[model samples]
Target: MVTSLYIMLLGHLINRAFYYLKQKWESRALPSPESHPASQGVLPMYPG
Candidate 1:
């Protein structure tokens, strides 16, 4: 069915996006001091 095909396409897109982001992050060495402000924008990894 077309609906099932659409769902499968969407799932593939999401998986690809996550994989790309992971690869991009891995290639990066580190952020500069100027970008420290961005850290504030991120929620703690483990929000205990």
Candidate 2:
């Protein structure tokens, strides 16, 4: 019924939001100096 449809829509929106946020965080985290092979030997990576 209407309630089922609403719940489905809400679940879809929440899943999409979580997926987007995880991708955004991983993109920002995966490229730091500590993870980068070239920078690992040269300098310490500091979190800002």
Choose the strongest candidate by TM-score: 2
The digit string of per-residue lDDT tens for model 2 on 1-48 reads 999999999999999998787667656765764556665434333333
Per lDDT, the best of the predicted structures is 2
The C-alpha stretches of model 1 lying farther than 4 A from their native spots are: 29-48
Each candidate: what lDDT?
0.60, 0.66
Show model 2 residue runs off by greater than 4 Å.
32-48
lDDT string, candidate 1, 1-48, tens digits: 999999999999999998787556534533443555465325323122
For all predicted structures, in order, the TM-scores are 0.52, 0.61
Poorest lDDT segment (10 consecutive residues) of candidate 1: 39-48
Error of 1 at 1 (Å): 1.6
